[model samples]
Every structure is written in C-alpha cells, then in structure tokens.
Target: MRTTALLFSLSISFGSLAQLQPIAADVYRWKDLKIEKEQTRERRQVLEGSARDLDLLEIHTSALEPGKSPHPPHTHDDVEELVIVKEGNLRVTIKGQSKILGPGSVALAIPGEEHGFENGGNTRVTYYIIKYRSKLPMNIDRGKQAGGSFMIDRSELTVKTTDKGSRINYFERPTSMAQRFEMHVTTLNAGMNSHPPHTHRAEEIVLLISGSGKIQIGEQHKDASVGDLIFLGSEVLHAFTNTGQEPCSYFAFQWN
Candidate 1:
C-alpha cells in the first residue's frame, strides 16, 4: 500500500538474507493495488519490496499532468532508477542534459546524480519507475557516456524471432549500479509459450504489456492480463503461456 518513494531511505537491507529466497509469494495484480494521488500526479506501487542480494527493489507507475513532474530533480545516495515512458512525451533530465522520451523509451538515473522527469507532451504522461539498490558496493552509472545517465528508445531495437513469436532485447550492457539486469520485449502467439515451466538462478519479472494469458508458478497457475506482473524467484519453477485468442506480449526483465 506504500512505495519506497524515489527518495526513501535504505537503512533496511535484504542483501544479507539467506540465499535462494522464493518470490512466488510476491505476485502483484495491478487491479488490486492501492493508488496514491496528488493534485499533479498519481501512482501505484505494484512490487515495492526486496530480493536477496538486493537491498531494495521497487517498481511503480505514475501519471503526471502536462508540464508537471512527480518530484524535483534530486540525487540519492544508494538507489539507482530507471524510467520507462509508457505513454506521452516524458522529458528526462539528468544534471543539465535532457531528452524528450516517447512511449516505450527508457532512461536511467544513476546514484549520486540529480535526475527527474517532466511531462513535455500536451497530455498526461505515464511512466514506470524501477528503483533498486544492491547490498554490495556499486557505482554511479556513466553507461557508455561519462555523465552517469543513459536513455534508449525501445523502438530502435531489432526484433529477434523466437519459435513461439518474437523478442527484442533492450540494453545488454551493464549500468553503473547493475551488471546483469537484462530487459526485453517478448510476444507469444496464441496458445504458445516461450519455454516449458522451469527454474534458474536469476530472479525474473514479467510485466504484461498487452493481451491476456496464463502463468504457472510451481504447481500454481493463474490468469493474467495487462498491467499484471508475474514474478519468478531464483530457482522457482515458472512459465508463461498465451491463452488468449490474440498474441500476448510482455516486457520481461531479469536480475541475477
């Protein structure tokens, strides 16, 4: 019902938890999430929690009125953030450099840097924030640049064909605070699946972007729709299937 608020303190750490913590109990449904609203913006935290080796792992979606920002540009000591523009033009600002990012675009705000976003478009701007911190020492991401900020237009990535449908990877490169947070756009044709139910060492997050489907976590299964998030903890058996009449597409990311 609450968020780690972009500026929240990380005095509490989960990085020291026992290894192989199962995250199957962390499934969050958008329709059932609590919403927080202000005069200029509103947001919902789907998964505002933690993971092993991760001190803080929070994700939220925010909608800001035209010309407004969720918060003023500020730097934090321990958190790194990613802003993925879902709709409208989100003007991402890091220090002085800025970019007008459209839907499907992503921007990274590294630790120890001043960064924020404004709705540069005529309409309300919606974007998702992925904020986190690792227990071990990390860095302020310079990315491929020296300014500690990075942006990627999701449309520019080439789609790779999969047996079920197709997938397009985003950045494979490491961020200042992260080394293996891989992101991609995956689609499954009706009645198709990317892989059989399985398990691995990395933690997985599947953010449903469109269409409806079903997910299996261990022996448990459930129906999933847009705005739903399917999580698979390290070594937790999980799989996704496109059960709808139409193809189901989702944004998939994993952190090891």
Candidate 2:
C-alpha cells in the first residue's frame, strides 16, 4: 500500500509540472500584399503563441501594399494600440483628424478610440504595431452597435520625418510590470555612430530591418544583418554604428 501511494503522489506532481511548461513561439510569414481588401493587408508578418504572447503583442517589419489596410476603425476596451512607421508613408485617421506617418514617426491610439490606416505611397508601407492587453479579456468589437463609428478618414494623418537621422520613438513608457519602447535607426550617407553610452531601466530587443550595422553592448559588439535580433539586459550600455555602404535602418523595443 505504501509503495502504491508513493507512486500516485509522484504522478500527480509530474502532471502539475507538465502543466506549468511554457508555450512555444509561432511565426507567420507574409506571402502576398492583397488578400482581404476591406480589412487586413496582404504583406504582413504575425507572431502568435506563448512566446510572443505577453501583456503586449508586437508586429515587426510589417509591409502593407498601397490598397490594403487592417480591420475597420475599431476600439478595444481593454487594450491600447501603438503604430510606428519604419519605411514608406501611411495615412492614419483617428477620431476626426488625419495625420501622415513617415519613417521614424510614432502614434498612439488609446483604448475605446476609433482608428484606421491606409498606405499613401506607391511602395509598400512598413510599420510596427504594438497592442497592450489587459488582464481581462478584451472586447474588440465594443461600441460597434451605438451611433459611434469605428472607421476613420484616411486623409487625416500627416507625414513628417524627424531631423535626428535615427532616433528612439517611444509609445508607451516603461512601467514596473510591463513597458515597451521602440526606435528607428538610420545610418548616414558616410556612416555615423550613436554615442554617449546610455542605459535605461528596461531590457532591450533589436531587429535589423534595412542595411547593415554593428551593435555594441557593454564590452561586446557584433555585426548585424537584416532580420538579425539582439537582446540586451537592463542597465547594459549599448550603441550602434552604420557600417554599410547604404544607410542602415533598424527598430528596437525595450520591455520591462
């Protein structure tokens, strides 16, 4: 009887451990630029599953064709949406105003607001989308039935580039629980470097989107190519330099 009881207890413990195992990461690639015209784009990458799923969901290096856009103006009562333009141009309509978002531009749409997007340039528009989730389940379709409209005029967004070649654009500040920061890096024609060695309160993850560069974190530095990802811990001094013939472009996000 003693032996049987011991085996049963061990089995229960093992079952509980299995349930606590983490979820795997899932990556979705973009095959085309036009599929659903009314909502969603053709060229877009989506990351889902346990690894990508956190308090926030981020879409990186997303490319949208000229005629395609995401879902109609909709509000999430429990989540905040952030958009950052990396390349090309886009028209973003929020409430009743339209703004143009060019490379290095960032915008934030609070929860319960109406928003939409449309590509304005001839080339594909690439941008990053970050959605912050609440502890409770988000009602994405909220306010659709009332007189409140979910669609925003595509002509309301204005486009402008920052003078600081490549600089950090933050949508959400770092908090004790979960924080997100994003930035765009544009190398100069003759190649330049970012300095003054700075550290912050959150960890950082970088994604190289265009051109080539080298990232120096603490005493370690390495060459980075397109699609390369680098992770740095909090309070780690880091900087980057443009090392390629053409201008190098990249995006980074810091999470706390």
Candidate 3:
C-alpha cells in the first residue's frame, strides 16, 4: 500500500510538469505585436512554446535606444541563443570577444557561453533573439568542441545571384541544442516564387526583412511584411513568394 501511494504521488507530481504544446505553423505579423516599453528599449514578444525537437523555444524582438543595452553579459547553462540584426548597428560580445555588426548580421551563442548586446549606432537598433532548449541532453563539452560561439557579418558573405533571385549563404553547424543548424538569406524577385511547395525534417522560421510576400503552409496562406515572421513545423508543406512590386528578402533558418 505504501509503494502504491508513493507511485501515485510521483505520477501526480510528474503530471503537473506537463510538456509544453508544440508551436503550430503560422505567421506572426509585426504590426500585430504589442510593444512593451522599457527603460532602455521596446520589446515585442513573438513566440514562446516547444518545437518538434526542442523542449523550449522562444523568440522575441527588441529595439534598443542608442548606447543602450538590454542586460549584462550572461550565461545560459542549457539554452542556446541566436541573434539577428535587423536595423542599425549592434555591438555584440561573446565570450569576451566583441564586434560591431550592421543590419543583416547574425550572432550565435551556444550553451554555457557569456554573451551580450548593445546599440552601437546613433540610431535605435532592432534585433531578434531566438532561444531554444533541445529535447536531447545538453552537452556543453561537445558544444565547445565545435565552434563555441561566433558572429557573422553580412558584408562578409558573398551573394550569389540566381535567375529568380539572390541567395546569401550563412552558417551550417552543430550546436548544443541542435544536431544541425542552418541559416541563409533569400531575396526573391518581384512576383517570383521562392520554390515549389516542399517539406523537410527540420523545423524552420522565415523572418521577412524587406518588401512584402506570402507564405503558404499546407492549405493556409499568410501575407507577410517587413518584420513579420513565418514558422513552419517539421515536414510541413510550405512555400514563399514575393507578392509585392519589389524584391523581398527574408532570413530562413532551420534546425533539428
């Protein structure tokens, strides 16, 4: 009877900590986001939930005033962070190394790394932050064995122009939270489709930065504008097209 009672108690305790629901494939419009004003910056909460292979996934954006910082350098023991600059110049420090990144730049901080950001330009700096905790066990040592932390300046990447559009290749690497993390920017010409409807095993996010477009996932379609984000679940049929009169550019990132 005592063993059975203990099991019941354990089950009840475990049930209280239920897993977070998986995020659905949808669009988060920039205009629809409610801005939360702060002392140094304004924040827009994007999404906060679990993904297919991640235990916790959170995304948000911040616009920092000139010479302002959201917080001091911090370390995440289990979560990995990815920051993408959208406007103005950002000063980012990772593991004691600092760099000034312009719009379209990216920074990645794996588990157990100290990182921080600040607006280094005269104008306000707008950037997105993506944090994820993988369902797999966190292996800090393995992450360090890889590249640890790094930043990519957009100017350093070569843009390959295609007949349909242009593509800027970013990084494809393994992190503490994902077996594979891949990112790139695609500029689709006006009225051009990014590609035919396709599916992949990795969940993906499309962050539109320029012009306007439409993203279709399954039977649902959503129009996107600058600062809007489109999230596609794993193996979900999705496609994107430039619906505006000018070219559209967006960052496409996927991770397992």
- Return the top candidate by lDDT: 3
The lowest-lDDT stretch of 10 consecutive residues in candidate 3 is 13-22
TM, every model: 0.85, 0.54, 0.92
- Per-residue CA lDDT of model 2 for 1-256, tens digit only, reads 9999999999998676445422221112233223333235643444421222244443434567886676566766655666767678877888867776777566666567778888878888877676655333543343232223222222343323444353443333432223333343443332777555678765555666677777787777777776555555557788878788886666666543
Q: Which is the leading candidate under TM-score?
A: 3
lDDT of 2: 0.56
Clashes of each: 0, 10, 0
Question: Which portions of model 2 miss their true places by more than 4 Å?
Answer: 1-40, 43-54, 133-200, 205-210, 216-222, 226-239, 245-256
Give lDDT tens digits, candidate 3, residues 64-90: 999999988899887999999999999
Candidate 2: TM-score? 0.54
**lDDT tens string, model 1, 5-116?**
5224332333343332334444578789788997779998877556765767778899998999887889977788888777889999888888898987888877777888
Off by over 4 Å in 3: 1-19
Show where candidate 1 strays beyond 4 Å: 1-26, 141-148
TM-score (C-alpha) between model 3 and the true structure: 0.92
